[model samples]
Target: MIDTATAPGSGGAPPAAPTRAGRRPATTSGPLRREYIWLALLLVGTGAAYLWNLTASGWANSFYAAAVQSGAKSWKAFFFGSSDWANAITVDKTPASLWPMELSARLFGFGSWTMLLPQVLLGVASVALLWAVVRRHFGANAGLLAGLALAVTPVAALMFRYNNPDALLVFLMIAAVWTMLRALDDGRWRWLVLCGLLVGFGFLAKQLQAGLVLPALALTYLFAGPPKLGKRIAQLFAAGAAMVAGAGWWVLVAQLWPASDRPYFGGSTNNSIIELTLGYNGLDRLGLGSGSGKPGGGGAPGGDPGGGVTAGVDLAAGGDMPQMHGGFHPFGGQAGITRLFNETVGGQIAWLIPAALILLVAAIILRGRAPRTDGKRAALLLLGGWGLVTGLVFSFMGGIFHEYYTVALAPALAGTIGAAGAVVWAERERRWVRAVLVLSVALTALTAFVLLSRTPDFVPWLRWLIVGVAVLAAAGLVLRGGRRLTIATLLAAVFVGLAAPTAYAVETLRQPHTGGIVKAGPATDSGFPGFPGGNRDAQSDPESGAAAPGGDAPGGATDAGGDADRERAGGGGPMGDEKPGDEVLALLEQDGSAYTWVAATISSNNAASYQLAADYPVMAIGGFGGGDPAPTLAQFQRDVTEGKIHYFIAGENHGPGGSSTSEGSKITAWVKDHYTATEVDGVTLYDLTATPKAG
Candidate 1:
């Protein structure tokens, strides 16, 4: 057990004298110097990796980027996370994740660097916090290793450098765990309350996904908290109250504000935040209900098809939806036990998962007889439960899954490996423990081989190198001799376990990713068969301006280029990557201040492109997938009659799979009936202010 092996002075050394606080005195200068040096190196390395070439993504997910832009322009938009300064409709989720970027953009002036820099800082802080948490129980070496593991996770590296909610969500989750563990150590009410507050803020970042850690937190405290039964129950109630307060204030404001004055609660059919939480962001995410409130209206893959306009296409001919770049499977490759290991997802966060699971079991069995309040066992329970619960939900959940969502698993896996590895190493003198260590390394190496084989052409030799090193390390562990030999063998094992993921992380950093859905590592056959390259842009017909069916386009176009060129060269369609042409931008900017909105579009993705370029509010008829009824046709007609909206840009109106006679389709039909179309460079626009022609 860890208690017997790692006890102070248990390894034939004199016990350190206790200070007035009943804690051991500080270690000698030599050991202290090395620990601080390693800590410094870990933090510096993480910051450098996350910050390298941060601007290459250039408004990464322009959907969020456009919202950040709106928030920077108007305080109302900032508070509501509206898609435009005019506050026609808010983005699909809560505004907490956008708050930091909005504040930064307001202070530094909005640009790619200003928008993304906050995310990078958050990623680095997560690494440092993970190290501190592990070091509090395990040794310094274990802490450094955990930090390194998290930093090199491919998905972690990708999301940290991009402007997405996952970065803030992950940071808040880790901080909550840290505080929960501190409470376990002392049975303090304040720490538990702080932990609740952190989780509540996490809810504001990504909704229900933040609550995945709640079970582990509550169970850990109940079993391992220093307080007696009655006090522990009382404290949990207090923590629950704090959590409600932390997350409820915003919900109250959004619900209590006069419906006519504030932005509509986006992603909700009834314009209610409560519905948005329990329906769209909650049950719909779990595949329990249609996210858009209509029957079968969720954004599931290959669902019902709806009609919409595309560049160079007529309103009657339902245009082809934009395809995912590289033919990557968007649902994380079907719901089941092996989902995480699928080609589309395995390369991101699955590299260390096998080892983490093995070590978690070993740590649990070794600590089985420890006392009820043992901190080491408590930490393992917290981390292991977190990884298991979150991983299973990710694997089997049938709705709206992305490969990058695996980033949530990074911190828990890293902490488990660090804590368990320390325990197994302390008992290395036992032959069975050494054998378990060898088996864990072999399994990890085998996993690396399979994942590496999927991307054979990318670092082809690395997989074989890992297998060879793993074998050598196993033999060295079985027949150890000197201390130097043991150290060398341990180094080989580390290389075998970390080399593959680290390579993938480095590759992720090299490429510039821009899209609503992104993956880590080089392109491989892991994507759907027949989609084998990294290019994400759909090919468009030069003369007709319509995207070619099943054609590929250039990927990673910068915002500095001509807007029309960027649209043609990138995956700009319903995917939200499209930018306005020079002619359209000029047209929209002319006398734009006279109207509340320069233009309106059916989907947020389509509207985000023009809104970002025009620097004006362009009402998204429906939120996100064009399903929620933010503005009914009557509302839109009222705006047009009052000369509030200038133009109506014709663009895609359906969600991913497609919608079924949703409000977006209705608005599009009415717009076409009432106005004449004007083509500018390839985009279709209708001037809403002009008198309607005879039907």
Candidate 2:
């Protein structure tokens, strides 16, 4: 939303009337009366999209779901994002995103509602916030359209309903944008400070990913904000300082805390939170660091045990096999410019990207030679820059990015479409603007058609129908039925733009995207192309007796971080078969006392399943990737001797960074060599209590 409301002595243009019938009502109260109705509709629609069948996925991404449960059980776990309430180690990513989920669990007790409800509410709030922000500067109609577009975006619906950090990240990023726009509206430094604070919280939500919009916000203020340069710079500095304080304090506290009192930083080789930030969460994600494809780089809590190196269990070891099919390319391709639009990712987030780009260029050109202070021009630049910067970063960054990461692009696309469409619609009476509308609708429909083609069998009829509607709508835009025809065509165009994503969203909701990077399309049994892991086939992990029914397994099926594996501990419903079955549970319960850890395993999902099944701490010894030095051989031996650990479950040896020589692997080897193995419920178990005590 763009406005020319000026502060005292600030040089700005007069506010343009809102586009067409979208004009502000005669009185402020009058506008609110009608606006509230649309806002309510937007909120309700978004809520339904996000909350419908919300628990079908059960504890979606049981990896993080376990963390949410842990955080609910203990304050220390809540702060550290510990997968088990025992606080042995932390999840790789920051815990800010999980705080709310944990709070919900604390209030409601652990269940699907605690796991998925926060995301649903956040999705609704995001829609409302988008409407308010767009309306403040654009108009009621434009704001409503923006909210609708965002609400229907396939990725938006998929992510807002899912329990990943991306949902909160998206919400915070949008909040930051709204705050910055408000700051620009009145040239208020306080608003700017608030924007910075929101962004800093965004950092806490997703680390460096949050800074993707800083460039756009900074540039907008520097080039287009009110009045003098010195004051502006000073105000920006204040904002920056506030941002540093908001984001840095947590890192500082994490670093300065006594190591003995805190869990080891999960992804950091050196056990430093700052190191984890700079390495795995920062440079590695950009493909600038060597750890790009390593465990924890994508900021997933329980990383792929082998770092997406290979899937399927190694029968000999009873865990993920470290067969070096390739150099840890989980999604299976080199990072490049075309990554987001490829087969694996295109259907998820790229469907509307081309339309957004076309609309942006058209908006800019339609405002040809407008004065620098023109509100429309300012709006175009602000939105264009925001979309371009975030989109480019995602496009070019060489990291272990998942398809679901496209959720970040949702707001940019929605904002661009809403604001640019308003500008174009406001000028639609112009022949050129009408032509632009026709072209925009055609491109949008065409792009959506191509994206839909990727999964031909999914609502196959809609493909031709959308193209036909788009063509007729364009013809109507050009025909002679006057404003009524034009309005119908515009509505048709909006319909065509939203239809594909709406269907995809419905499909997304209908299917249980329980694990791995969720790509929008009809749910398929095929695993990700070039995925080096197990085929998306429902099979039992021979060691765990954990059967994945129809490829939607419980604990191990997901990739971790974004789209995760569907494998749960139990076989059905929210909790799934998280328990270790009756036999294993009985054996473990026989000597449950005097042991700190219920079971030890290399897979985070494995441990998560056990933790959820038993509601007791199961140590994911080596962390998500089975690579982090959460427990070395010496530490394990010492713990066993001290009776801190009881059972050691054998599983995958491969860690994210390398081969089976990791701390967790060594401990497993030592345990295997010394202790007698017991096969309980398909899991190879080592009873530490059965070993003789060495004097």
Candidate 3:
């Protein structure tokens, strides 16, 4: 392969360097023009894929959607992560990721489109930004491939189209990557500062998850940056400081403020943002503590000896993934070495893992230990290290790992695949490069077939067709081929790598997902658990009264009578079953109150639905799980006596004999015993205003 920098010329000299002002010397503009066209297509295609039928799910996770809506209403709620503008308590995670959604809702008047539009735009922008970053170092083709690979990855499509923090997390991380690369190229301190700011802002999006790329990025710069060793260290230190300023300002402010002045941090035991960061969102995720780890049944960390709240057990964790039946855990079920490649998770994000691995290995061998300063070596380190390290973390992290969390792995995977493609394409004349490309496509196709086989209910023919095309594309590369045939072979390889995932993504779009965690795909049948789109007839389970895991009703609630009702109420809405029902709203309106809270409910989702529906503040009594003791029994009594709270919606709890037993059980029991139960819309409501004072 000819190096453009050293191509034959009168002196066989390297190309002239760019001026100090950073303008490049003029060259033939054809490649640049072609790149622009490819970029345009990539953006347009990504937008179309993400935006198509986007609102079909209608506020993907009511949990976050409610938070976004609340944020739009109150600046305090926006910053504190409250799901309601009551500003009583924060959501489990921080509010950094919700900022854009809040702004969108505020500007667009709060609807499904407003909730999700930012995610769509962010996803598209990330693709464009990734292209720019890759093209700067590896030329146009590699950039185009990287952008396309990221844009089409099924999980990427699913996450970007949904109202999840991951969309913004990914975008900010990409921006950080792009800026970091720029800093390396320009050897400028300002770029490093900007990189830090981006990463810090990313931290706001997802706490520690956003920082996973930091070590690799910082180390890469220290080794390969153009500055002297002393200067690089100093600059990296400055960048680290900038990162802390950007990401930690909120934590600092939240901590310094009097507890009475701000909402309680939802996920933390003592309402401390720092604890939330270091524990639930930090160390516990690494399986070192009690924070929510991967999908399995891991124990929560015990409390601090000083009487801080201890982490609780999460049953939903490894028992059986929600909504999945037939042992096909689309989201990982257990934390282990092979989690990512297993049948449960592979199809969603691992469509090209085999191909990327093969290409990475081949490229590493072909590059033959190039010097640190070599562009190829740096590119390999940046992309390959990011992919491998992240994949391993996601595979082994022992806490609350969700299927969508794997979207973090998408960009790195795409980058490595693109970098490998570029190296192989550059060496197309070599038999070994061609052979590696063939091996990559074959592995990708075979792996994709295996993943698709795990869900035979989805169209199986698509897998066979993808495999056949991939095989043919591999053959085309080995056969005597013209330039057009070579291009065809490349296209075939791209198609095979993308086709199966694309089909799965299409099915995901066709279906609807709700709840705190969701996956992309149609229900296999009416019996499929957690699937809101299952056939109505197949969903009924007479014994449990609740539909099975995958068999959730379209409204997101189960019809099961007792425990299921509690789950539905506790889980919050998009349950489709929840309706403000003119009756419920009218009843509340008729009974005016001096209290800021119009009513109280167990779960944040329940309160969120009522608040959004009624445009009133309803207390989410026990936080998200109905397990957090947000407001104590004593507090509720004081609020009642002082006229700070009115109605209390009773009967949502997890206890023996379907009785009330959760964090706020004392409150629930107190309300039940004092205020007479009035059934409205099949929910037991209590008129707190009617209760007699305790002597």
Candidate 4:
């Protein structure tokens, strides 16, 4: 269907006419000059968008924020990603993602701005790297378009601005792809090794999620690499070794360290990093066990944790509301091929998927007859494979899935769309190529319409406008015209594809997103119910019982003060969104320096709020989800008897699957049984050293 005679080579552009000296002309002339200008604009625009309101979330996801604070104060905590400087328990994730933020906080004094600035920088760098990777094979225009797509992707906007490990994980994945591509170019062992090294570091960033790209990387190189079969196999082996060395050293050190001397491995049932990696962060994530037993617990997005208000429930017609697991659903919907297009997920990163896949198939078929070393086909295979593999896993994986995890797919989608668009455009004179391009634009427009319709009240007219423009652009493309008219039609097509996602991205920037689970765009009818159309302030809804923005209460608690009894009765929830009230901070800070733990609480998020507000080491009893057996009853009682732990803050002792038998629940029961409860600014606390009273 494609005319190979007119198709551009791997360089995308025709080779420049040879000069007298037989060298390429200076880059300042023509297309090369334009490329530089556009590249600069892309980077500048991406940086501004990402940094627009960097500190508005104010320590977004306080669970990790608390870890960053602790890491700043204690090198041991920094290395271990401990929730407290006293080395009580590490955060459930590996520490690589926190290192940059910790170092920033250590240098500038921990605060919202310092803690989140590094994440913004990582976001900007990822965009720039993506541009470079795409530009190498495609022309400047395609590279710029790909970069723009990623920058405006809603989830990319969310995670890049938020302090989540996903940001670093994404950056490493893109860099690895770039390095692997370089290896394929020349069969260079060093390039392959470098790619392996990046992936290894990626493992440290988020464990096995980093390995999803490996199959694509290895398969592409094995099939398309310039080296002979034996040599390519040997080179891949070296790269694998590099990957092990890069990621293995940390695993080795962590496993070898004395468990007592280090913070307990927070996610593991046993104090073993190996178990944490292989179990909690690994197998459990694949639906083999309770999905990670993560902090928020899994349910539909914005669904009531108690199942009183199901995500899709209509409170106006209320009868018996369905009860489901509390917290956001790991995947947006049931695990299936269409999961990415569901109401909860489509708006985040699925905007361009339909277009990307269409164009990917077109590009691969167009280049099917090219030699094995063809760079264009290799790139298509690499990016398309990455997107397909990662997308399927996110769609079907039964473990702790979140809508935001879709950020991993953004780079691949963006790159594939750009590369494929270029390949097909080069042969646009072929009627079939034009048909494929028009089909892609039409499908993308339809996708936007469906996604926008889910949140009908917000930007109601934009969806129709996108469809209108796409229809016109498709017509214009079908009917050959003058060069200016063709360019105009192409611009309209691009607008149709990008408009809704950009609007969602901007909305994501406008909102103040906090807590362990967050969704992009304005609240939709399917996921978040309490907030009316376009009202994202869940804290303002008294019925929601969510922590107010910047308030130091746990995520699922009532207001401080008059509701103390109800709050104590209800127990604490996931990540707290607000700062600790001043009175509570003062209470925790009083003579806090003398104790190893200024206070202790059931969940990491609750303890994170108090520790961050008081600037002290507050122990998270059983780590995130309050389920891990970190400090046993004996260990906690010993600490309390020795005056190491000063107070026990009343909070949720049980998590999604936890019970009274959990170590955290036992600690809470023991403390409540022994000490007099004191109400500080509506927070219940038991003084560990005030002397036990007969209950």
Q: Rank the candidates by TM-score, best first.
A: 4, 1, 2, 3
lDDT per residue as tens, model 3, 389-469: 788888877554566788988988888887776766656667877788788888888888888888887887988999889
lDDT of 4 by residue, 546-631 (tens): 33334533234344432432253343422354455567778789999999999998767667767877888999876755666768
> Number of clashes in every candidate structure?
2, 31, 29, 11
C-alpha local distance difference test of each model: 0.74, 0.67, 0.67, 0.75
lDDT minimum window of 10 residues, candidate 4:
299-308
Best by TM-score: 4
What local lDDT does model 3 show for residue 345?
Answer: 69
Which residue pairs come into collision in candidate 1? Answer: 537-553, 572-578
* Cα lDDT tens digits for candidate 1, 502-534: 999998887666656567887443322111111
RMSD of 2: 6.3
> After superposition, which runs of candidate 3 have C-alpha atoms over 4 Å from their true positions?
3-23, 27-30, 291-331, 368-371, 524-577, 589-594, 654-663, 693-695
Better of 1 and 4 by lDDT: 4
- Rank all candidate structures by their lDDT, best first, as comma-separated numbers: 4, 1, 2, 3
- Against the true structure, candidate 1 reaches a TM-score of 0.88
* Model 2 per-residue lDDT tens digits across residues 1-695: 22313211111222345443234435455545766876887798778767876765666666777788889998988987887887878878788989989999889888766678999998898888877666666666777778888888777878887777888888888888887776665577887899888888888887888888788888878776664788878888988998888788888888888887877777778788777778778776666766433433222334333333344433223243333222444552435677667766676777667777877887788666765445556666766787888777777665565767888888878888887777666666568767877888888888888878888888999989999999989898788376567567777888888899889888877655554444555654433431212223112221212223223234343312111221221111112123345576666566665567887776576677667766678787767656677776887788788888778776555333334556766776688678887766555678887855353
User: Model 1: which ten-residue window has the lowest total lDDT?
Assistant: 540-549
After superposition, the stretches of candidate 2 with alpha carbons farther than 4 Å from their true spots are 1-31, 292-301, 304-334, 367-376, 525-579, 589-594, 654-658, 693-695
